[model samples]
Target chain A: MNKPTVLIIDDEPQIRKLLEINLSSKGYAVRHAESGKEGLLLASSHFPDAILLDLGLPDMSGHEVLRQLREWYSRAIVILSVQNGEADIVNALENGANDYLTKPFRVGELLARLRSAIRHSDASTVVQTVETGQLEIDLMARVVRRAGEIQKLTSTEYNLLALLARNEGRVLTHQFLLKEVWGISFQSETQYLRVFIAQIRKKIEDDPNRPVHIITESGVGYRFQ
Target chain B: MAAVKLHPFWQFLIGTASIALLAMVCYALGDSMDQWAVALILLAAVSVLAVLFDIIPVLAAALLSALLLNIFFIDPIPDYKIRDTESALLFFIYLFIALVNAVLTNRLRKQEKKIRDREEKEKTIKLYNTLLNSLSHELKTPIATIIGSIDTLKEIDPEIGSQQRMELLAEMEIAGNRLNKQVENLMNMSRLETGTLKLKRDWCDVNELIFLVIQKLPATDTIRIRFEPDESLPLVKLDGGLIETAVYALVHNATRYTPKQTPIEIVTTYNKENNLLIDVLDSGLGIPETEISHVFEKFYRLPNSGTGGSGLGLSIAKGFVEAHGGTVCVANQAQGGALFRIVLPVEISRLHV
Candidate 1:
């Protein structure tokens, strides 16, 4: 079997070096590009299995790159950004990037995120059940269970849980979630999403205050692990 | 114009005296001028006083002039008596003129004060803009360092010497750390200014917090940081993300101010009052006595300190801590160095774990 390949687009040499050394050691072929233009050209010619993009590129913004890539490319594209830059991360995710990692992240964390992003994008099998930390959500049956206990959830609650479960490790933004669970007109009703999420957390999380199954990305959105 | 402002009392004394002198002049020139004409001249004098003095003194002058007109320049001079119907009417008319002058002048003065207030507000907005411009300007040094180093590395034709290569990389790391610090400070300041900082209060373990923040600090081996968590410490409910940034700024400042080979210690304890007290103690030359008060002020750099910082770190720390209903204090330790403390009020239930 051929080894999976990864492409990195970043202006900082140190970040590119870190990604290259770490990704290469994990048995994946790695390619590097220093600017947005070169990254787009190399991505077309090489068609790497996964792409790591930095938002602060010199040639073009990371949002612009993601927008152009989404027109044709359909593989996993994980964004890299500085910490507390929630707006940019949300924009990238909304622009069809699968996942994101803040800079200075540990190598293990990056590898884990890359693995999840690549797996979900190429997932041909329709998942019926999602399980994390003893919380099992059966999408096909519209059921939720904690350990062996069946959780009774409202119809709205079930839909929200099912949506987050299906997109497992990806950060779904507030606007996207509101539109998907509610209608397009409800995109700006973030308070509704918050109330519903609190209810869902009480049902699924062991300690709803410190949730593990459904984690909040603060101002961005939620990530179901 | 050089503003020769008079005290309100002095203005009142001068205005009333000037009205009295005008009344005396009219009394002396009584046969030459009509009583009604005298009233007109007195009203004009009161209006001039309103233009030059404060409202209180101007209003007082108007009333005094009317009283003087009645007492000294009336139909029955030196007596509070009206002799003829026309003269009584002229005296009342003179009094009415003074009252009208005060009212109109009072209204005009209030309008002028309102305009001045609006101008002050615009000045404040302009100052904020200047602050923002200077902040962006402060970012240029680190950016230049990063670009200049990269440019040098790129121009190398042959295999770069390993020692020089490592130095360049180290320089870039330091510059990147400085750049990131400025960006973090800028974001936190904007968040505070815009009121967009929403506290996400979750259970926070002090042990894990210390580990995470230390790991996140710029890669450095020079200054040693030591902390041992209290085994019985319970999880405090607060915004872990914000508190982490606050603590990072404090410790980061210590790293910059303290010299090499010195150690920085962080001690977290649950106080008797049920507040979480965090003390970051550093062994170095303590902050100057004069600068202690101004340390938390935004962009207030110490006059003699040659450190390169945006001076927003401490202020942001104080702001975040305060947002959580907490207080931050700094004091020069008696032994040496500075002691920084953060006290956060937490729920009573969080204490027993």
Candidate 2:
């Protein structure tokens, strides 16, 4: 198997240096750029497997860079930013970024997110079934089973769960989820999402209050683990 | 000017009504009171309104008084139009004096307000300077230590012993962690002070929120933080990020202030009013009653407390909680411990999709 290439676009020299050391030691090829324009140029020539794009770029807007790369590139583009605002995170995700991690992130967490992003992007084939813990979701059958027993779920509930399960370990924002499960007009109806999520948690989670399979990403979004 | 903010409509009503009352009083003393005296009194009333109330109300009062004077005080008995030259001259002159008084007093009040606003702005700048000075010290210490340790490591790269190298590396990590914490606190404080701290609310499970907060805190050998979530707690809508930071601050404070091997407990429950309640209890020495109130104040540290924090944590916590229209308070427990409680009015989700 070939080693995956990871490109990091960050203006801060120390952060770039530390990330290079941390990532290279884990046997991944790391390329870096200090500005958004340079990053986009290098990305075209390098065709890296995964890109770490910083939101606060020096030359142009990082969001603009992400959008430009996404126009042609079909690989994972994880965002690295100092902005921890929910709106910022949601905006990045909505603009086609695969994952978002705030700066000063733990090395272990950054590596994990990178691994998940690369792993998901590498799988060209469609996923038919998603499994985590004792919960099993069979996409073709449109059936959810808990502990080998078929758990009854409404059609809408099944669609919502399957969508979340299909993108396991990646956060799906409320707007995205509502638009996908419901419609674009239902994007602002977060109350409906809340009610459905609570119902799903009750049916699947051992403790609905302390859910582990379906993780809430603060006020930004939700992720199925 | 009175501190009480009377509405502009009420001020206009009161000012106009007072002028009518004065005219009626002059009518009761019909033969004795002079029309000139009534005009003088009305001009004085307009000036008083300008000084005490807003410009719009004062302007209205001035116009109303002029009309009142023309209708009753003029020589032509109860005539809307002034016929004689003396009465007409008196009307124009009275109108002129009343308008001038209103304009002058209004300008004076505006200038006074401008001076007051500038003074307040100066005070804010002074406070910002104090915060910056304190932050410099807090931020520089960790950075200095990190640079010093890293430099020493670089110079003695080959000669340093394994244990010594490990110690230096650990020291660097500690300094780096402290630096990161201070930077985070400074960013949060800036967001709060600039009025940019907006809550991004969503449906969240409080138990999970507390669990995540605990997972984020640095692990220590001396104390252990425990959580006992209410089993029947519903998924409530809230800004999970803000509430997490608030609860984290309270629990982190307990770990820093208490003795080693102390057990910290976090309990969550909803009251009858459907407000989500979170309590962080510590079995350490309780806070002094006098210090409790000041604990949540910005840059307020306990007199006997050791130095580690920039004294912004609790204040930031209070700010975040208050942004949610919530309340956070502290009380010493009966069993010689301190309890920090946060109460937030949250919408409980009970629907089944």
Q: Compute the lDDT of residue A81 as modeled in candidate 1.
A: 95
Best by lDDT: 2
Per-model lDDT:
0.83, 0.85
Candidate 1 chain A: 10-residue stretch with minimal lDDT = A189-198
List the RMSD of every prediction in angstroms: 11.1, 5.4
Write candidate 1's Cα lDDT for B253-283 as tens digits: 8988888769999999988888998899999
- Badly placed stretches (over 4 Å) of model 2 are A123-169, A177-214, B1-14, B22-51, B54-126, B221-223
Model 2's alpha-carbon lDDT is: 0.85
- Model 1 chain B: lowest-lDDT 10 consecutive positions: B344-353
Off by over 4 Å in 1: A1-82, A85-98, A103-112, A119-225, B1-137, B219-223, B348-353
lDDT of 2 by residue, A1-225 (tens): 777899999999998999999999999999999999999999999999999999998789989999999999989889987745567778989999988888778898898888878867776858899988899999998888899989888888888888889888888898999999999999977778877887788888888766888887776778888
Q: Number of the top candidate by DockQ?
A: 2
lDDT of 1 by residue, A1-225 (tens): 788999999999998988899898999999999999999999999999999999999989988988988899999999999888777888888889999999877688899889889888896968889988788998988989998799999999899989999988778888899899998998866656766776787789886645777777755788889
Cα RMSD of predicted structure 1: 11.1
Q: Best candidate, TM-score-wise? A: 2
